[model samples]
Target chain A: MVSFTAGDAVARRPAKPGRLSRFFFAGNGAGYMFLAPWLIGFLGLTLGPALASLYLSFTDYDLLQSPRFVGMDNYVRMATGDAKFAAAMKVTFIYVILSVPLKLIFALALAMAFNRGIKGLPFYRAVFYLPSLLGGSVAIAVLWRQLFAADGLVNSVLSVFGIDGPSWISNPNYSLYTLVVLSVWQFGSPMIIFLAGLRQIPQDMYEAANMDGASKARQFFRITLPLLTPVIFFNFVIQTIDAFKAFTPSFIISAGTGGPINSTLFYTLYLYQEAFGFFRMGYASALAWVLVLIIAVFTAFSFLTARYWVHYDE
Target chain B: MNDAAHAAPPGDTPERPILHSVLIHSALIGVSFLMLYPLLWMVSGSVRPADDMFGGQTSLIPSQVTLQAYKTGWFGLQVSFGTFFLNSLAISVLATIGNVMAASVTAFAFSRLEFFGKSFWFALMLGTLMLPYHVTLIPQYVLFLKMDWVNTWLPLVVPKYFAVDAFFIFLMVQFFRGLPRELDEAAMMDGCSAWRIYWKIVLPLSLPVLATAAIFSFIWTWEDFFGPLIYLGDIHSYTVQIGLRSLIDSSGTSDWGALFAMSVLSLIPIFLIFLFFQRLLIEGIATTGMKR
Candidate 1:
C-alpha cells in the first residue's frame, strides 16, 4: 500500500528546469548524507579489508615484515603438506555438523513443548533463553571448562551413579564433545525462532487433519514438519554459519592452544593462532579465504539442495 | 484467541487429563533445571570455600558459603576485576551508543529516503551479514595496526560509530520499513528536512527497535572476547572477557574458587540485563530471527 521508491519521490517533486536543478532537489543528497557513516564503514572496513585480505592471501606476510608475493604457495601447502590444516578442517567440520543439527533439534523440541500452551510460557522461555544470551560470554566458556573438568560437576554427577567420567576438557577425544555439548546447551535462540515459526502455522491445517482421524504424531509429520521446513532451512543455514564461526568456547577451553593434540582445533581458532600466535599473517589470510570459500560453498550447496526439502506456502 | 485455541488442540479435546498436564509440567521443569544446572553450579562454586570448590562436588548448595572467593577474585590479578568491569562498561556503552545512532541513521536512509545505487548498497549490506568475519579479520587488524589504533579502544569502538555492524543496520531497516509512510509524508509536506523527520518523528516512534539495538550492541560488545584479545594488549585496558581469560591463563586452575567467583561476577551484568529486559530481548529475537 505504501510504495516510496526514489522514482515515487521524484514524481512527487515539482517540475524542474534542468538536470542540475533536479539533482539538487532530489532525495539523493539527503539519502547519501544519511548513509555516510554506513557507506564509510562498508568501503573502509568491510570491502576494503576483504579485498586486501584476498591479496594478502597470495603472499607470505608476517606482521614484522613486508609481504612476499608467493602466489598459490599457501594453498598448495594447505592441500599437500599441512597436517594441522587438515586436522583443523576435520575438527571444524565435525563441530559444525554435530553441533548445528543437535542444537536445532533440541531447540525445535523445546520450542514445540513451549508452544503447547504451558502455564508459565514466558518464564520458561526466559529461563531457557538465558543460557543462549550468555553462551558467547567468556564466563560461560570458563564455566564450561570447569564443568567438564575431571572433578567437575559433570563428572561429579556421573560419580553419584557409580560411573567414572573421563576428564572431558583435557582429553582430546572428549574435549570437542564438551564444546558440542556446550553448544547444544544454548539452544534457546533457535528455539525462540522455531517457536515463532510454529505459531505461524495455521491452526486450521491441524484441525482439518484431526477431522480425518489422523493421529497426533501423524499430523506432526504430515502437517507440521513439511510446513516448518522453510524455517528449518533458515535455522540450518544460520546455525551452521554460527557454529563455523564459533571461537570463544574453544579458545577459552583450549586455553588458546587448540591443543591436547589439537583435537579441539576449530578453524577460526586455527586461523587466530596462525595470524596472531605465530604471526603468520599471510597464511592466516589464506586460511581466512579458505574459510569464506567453505562457508560460501556450503551455503550455496544448501540453497541448491533446499528445493528438495524446504516447503513454502505457494 | 480463546484458551482452548491456545492449548494443545490437535491431540485432544480442550480439557486435557490431569496426568498429561502434570507430566508435561514436570518434564518442562526437569529440562529447565538441567539447562540451568551449570550456571547454578558456578554460582554455588563461587560462594563455596576454596577447599570445597572442587573434588567431585556437584551440589547446588555449598557446604559453607563465604565471600572470600569474591574478595580474592576481585583483587586476584595484576589489575583488579573492578577495572576490567569498568573497561568493559565503558566500551559497551560507547559502542552501544555509536551502533544504535549510526544504525538508525543509516536505516532511515535505506527505508525512507531514496538514492541512486540504493539497491546495490542494500544488497552489499545483506551480503556482509553472511560474510565470515575471518575474511576481514587479518586486514582489519593490519589496518588498525598501521593506523596505531590497536592498543586503544579505537579498534574495538570506532568501527561501531561508522556502522560496521551491518546486522544492526539491517535490523533497524526492517523496523523502519514497517513504520507508516503517512507520518513521513505529512512531515515532508510541513517542509521538514529529512534529518528533522528522522530525529523527531521516526526515532521517537522507534524506541522499541532502538532499545533492542542498544541492548544487543551492549551485550555483544561486553561479551566480545576476540576483539579485545586481539587489540587491547594492556591488562588494565582488558574487557571482562579478556580479564576472565587472563584469570585462567595466569592462575591455571590453582585458584578455582577465585576463578568461579570472577566468572560469576562477569555474568552478573548479562544476567541483570536479561532479568530486566527479557521481553524486549525475546520479542527482538522472535521478530527479527536474529541470534543473540
Candidate 2:
C-alpha cells in the first residue's frame, strides 16, 4: 500500500536546501496537530461541562425529565432552607481548618527532623509516604472503620489505661475527628515538599546564627520559619483544596449515608448524593458552582495576602 | 574554636550528642507505629478466624492461622476477586500507555513549537489541574450515558487518549524544557523534520519523565474508586475498589474475615509498585511541587 522513492534517503543530505521546504513548513501547523488531543479534551470535557453546569445551576433537572427553568431558586434554597447543605458546609470548614494546620505542623516538624542528617532517610521517607500513596484507597478507609470499631484497636488501647474510648467511626461526636486523624496521618506529601524546601536553605546561615550565640529555637524562628513560609503557603493552598475534595474515606466509612447525625458529611459527598442518590442534578450543579466559588475565593485571598508572610529569599 | 569548626559538616547536629539521635529516632519509630499499626492489623485480621476479628482481644497475631478467608473471598459473591484484579490491570495498563503517549506528544509541542495562543493554552492546561472534578463530573456522566458507555471502561479510559490529565502534561513540559535545543537544530541541519527530531531525539532523551508519567498513571488508575463507582453498574464488571466497597456494604460484618482478606489483597499491587519505584515516585512528586 505504501511506496518509497529510491533517491529520497539521498535527498536528506546536509549540503542542500530544498525550494519548497520553507513554504510547506512555514508555520507550526504540525504543532497544533500534536496538541489536538488536549485541545479537544479542553473543549469537550472541561469547558463544555463547566458551561453546562452553570446553565444547569439555573434549572431544576433530575435526570428523568427536561430541566424546568427556576432561576435563582436553587441558590435561594441552598442559602436559606437546606439544613443538610449548611451541615455539610460546616463539616467541610471544620475539616479544612483543623486538618490543614495540624497536618502542616506535623509535616514541618518531620522535615526538620529529617534535615538533621539522619541515616536511612530513604527508609523513613518510604514508610512515611506509603500512607499518602494509599490514603485515598477504599482499603484504607475500610481499615479505618475497622480500627475504630467499638471493640477495635483504639478502644482496646484505651481500656488498657482504664479509659473508655467511644466508637470513633460510628459516634457523631468522634467521627469527624477520626477523619481529621486520617487527613493528618497522610502528612507525607507535604512532609516531602517541606523536606525539599529544607534542603534548599543555605547551611551557612544556620552556622552563622550558631556562632552569633543564637539558640536552636532562635535559629528556627529566624531562619527556618521565615524561609520555609513559601513552601508552607504552597502546601496550605494545595491541602485546603484537597481537604475540600475529601470524599472516598467518608463515603466508604459511612456507607454512603453521611449519617451518624451528619457529622462526616463532606461537601463533595453531599453534591454526589444530590446528583445521583436523590437525582437532584440541578441542585448538585448549583452546589458544584458554589464549591468552585469557595475555592477560588480562598485561593485569591491567599495570593492577595501572600506578600506579607510568604517570603521568597531570591 | 578550630576544633569546633572542624568537628563535622555544618548540616550535622552537635557533636557527641547521642541523646539527640535517641530522641529523634524513638519519636519517629513511635509515630511510625501509630501510622502503620492499622494496616498491619488488617493483614493479621485477614488470616485469623472470623469471630476473633471484632472481639475485644487486639493481638497483632492470631492464636491460629488459616487461609479460609482468602479462599471464600477469592470466590466472592459470584465472580472471583481475580476477575477484579485482571480488570484493574487491563484498564490501568491501557490507560497508562494512552496517557503517557498523549501527554508526551502534547508536552513536546508546548515546549518545542511556537504557535498562536501558545501561552494561553499552557495557562489553561495548568488551570485544569486545580479545577475540581465535580465541576465536570455531571456533564461528562451525561455525555457518557447518552453514548451508552455507562457500564464500560470507555468512560474511564477514553479521556486519557485525549490528554485529560493536565498534571502529566505539565510534568512532561517541564522535562522537555530542560532538554537542549541544539539537538533539534542539528537534526534540522541534517534535513530531518520536526517529527523525526521528536521521535529520534527528544523522546530518547526524556525517558525519565515519560516513565514517571506512566508509573503515576498506572497507580492512580489502579486505586481509583470514585470514577469506577460512578460509571460501572454491573457487578460482573467491577474493579477491585468497587468490589471491596460492595463487600463492605453488602454483608456488613457477617464476613469480616473475608472482607479484610479482600481489602489486604486489593492493596498488594500498589504496595509492590510503591516498593520498587519509591525513588522515581518521590522524585516526580518533589519536582512537581518545588518547580512550580
A31-129: candidate 1 lDDT, tens digit per residue? 999999999999999999999999999999998889999999999999999999999999999999899999999999888887767789988998889
**lDDT per model vs. reference:** 0.90, 0.87
Lowest summed lDDT window (length 10), candidate 2 chain A = A1-10
Deviation from native of the Cα of residue B206 in model 2, angstroms: 1.4
lDDT of 2 by residue, A1-314 (tens): 12345366455642354544543454357778889999999899999999999999999988779889899999999999999999999999999999999999998898889996786788888889989988988998988887787877889878888888888888999999989999999999899999998988999999888878798899999999999999999999999999999999989989998878999999999998999899888999999999999999999999999999999776
* lDDT digits (tens) for residues B1-292 of candidate 2: 5447545655666654556677888999888887888888889989997767764667798878999899978886777888898999999998999999899889988998777778999999989988998999988988999999999999889999989989999999999999999988888799887788889999999988998888899988988998999998998889999999888877785787888899999999889989888888898888887211
Per-model TM-score, in order, reads 0.95, 0.93
Residue B210, candidate 2: alpha-carbon lDDT = 90
Top-scoring candidate (TM-score) = 1
Residue B84's lDDT within candidate 2 is: 91
| Model 1 lDDT per residue over B43-158, tens place | 88899988887677878999989999999888888889889999999999999999999999999999999788899999999999999989989999999998999889999989
Runs of candidate 2 with Cα error greater than 4 angstroms are A1-25, B1-16, B290-292
